[model samples]
Target: MMTLYGRRGWGSVLIEAQLAYYDLPFRFEEVDDLFTSASARKALARINPLAQVPTLLLDDGRVLTESAAITLHLADLTGRDDLVPGADAPERAAFLRWLVFLVTNLYPTFTYADEPTRFVADATAAKAFRARVDDYAQSLWRMVEHAAAAPWFLGERRSALDLYIGVMTRWRPRRPWFLAEAPKLHAIAQAIDAEPAFAGTLARNFAE
Candidate 1:
């Protein structure tokens, strides 16, 4: 069985949701304290050099880190092109484009917003950086809103992108903001929130 080291409501939720979608048997190790606990950090470091959660210990013993990578791997393992467009599919390019945008452009902003002190030496500077990054992330989200596929990011069919965006939107500049600024993406997030296939997984991670 595969072991997934991650916390509730974090990026790892996407991977866990995927696993649930495929009804794959795996063990979940709650290492949500990786950033705050010494022992947890050390343990996570043994599996992920970056000391990040959402680290998957494969049955073969290889450790996989990074949320997007893990989600893609799960899709590949299940051969679920329905969830992740196959390599030859025309939608694959668009899928990658949006996935990369969220992982690269939006994910980093959340990192900085969550721990601004890591990037700046002074407290005031850190405060400013956090605010700036939040604004930037919001702007990027609006841009994506224009490109979204109404009830989903990849058009009529739902993909892993929907799951990811649903969880991510719950973070800073949350769903309420999206409801106001990015109506389309907001609808997409809500749709994912109500998706029956992922209902149990999502409720387990996000009780509210």
Candidate 2:
């Protein structure tokens, strides 16, 4: 069995959807806000010093941190080329590009946008920063929308990228903005959102 430590509606949603789609047995441990919950703080420290969610505890007792790392690891562990293209595959470059685009650009911005005070002491500065970050994130999502290759980001086969981007579309700038500004990416997310395999998993994390 695999154990996942995460906060509801976070990046862990993608991992949960993946595990569900692949029929993997897993358990989830909800971590309270790392800054405020003493129990969440201590529990996360034991496995991940950063106190981040989406930490995967393997059956062998090894732990995996970082959402992208965990997603790639699962693909490799299952030897699913469709899920994770091989290095030699021509699409691999595109895959790496978009995946890195996601984690590097959007993830950090999302973090700071959500908790602007972490970066600056002045409340005014934090608010300004978050506003800027919000605009930047919307622009970045537009880039993703332009990159869409139809039916899915990478063409035919669904990869972890689709799962990830789909869930994230519901965050921050949100589905409403996507509907207006990123019609292409919005369609892809709608497709993934409609996947029956992920319905329960998504509801567990995102249903209001």
Best by TM-score: 1
Regions more than 4 Å wrong, model 1: none
The alpha-carbon RMSD values of the candidates against the true structure, listed in the order shown, are 1.3, 1.4
What tens-digit string does per-residue lDDT give for candidate 1 at 1-208? 9998888987788788888889998999998465468888887888788887678999999988887888788888987798889999878999999888898899988766887787797999999989999888988998888889856888877888888888888898988998989888888888988989988999999986
lDDT, residue 9, candidate 2: 92
Which candidate comes out best when scored by lDDT?
Answer: 1
How many clashing pairs in candidate 2?
A: 0
Give a tens-digit lDDT track for model 2, residues 33-114: 8756878888789899887777899989999988888878888888777767787887888988898899889988877778
The residue pairs that clash in candidate 2, if any, are: none
Candidate 2, residue 111: Cα displacement in angstroms equals: 1.3
| lDDT, residue 195, model 1 | 88
- Model 2 worst lDDT window (10 residues): 34-43
Q: How accurate is candidate 1 locally (lDDT)?
A: 0.85
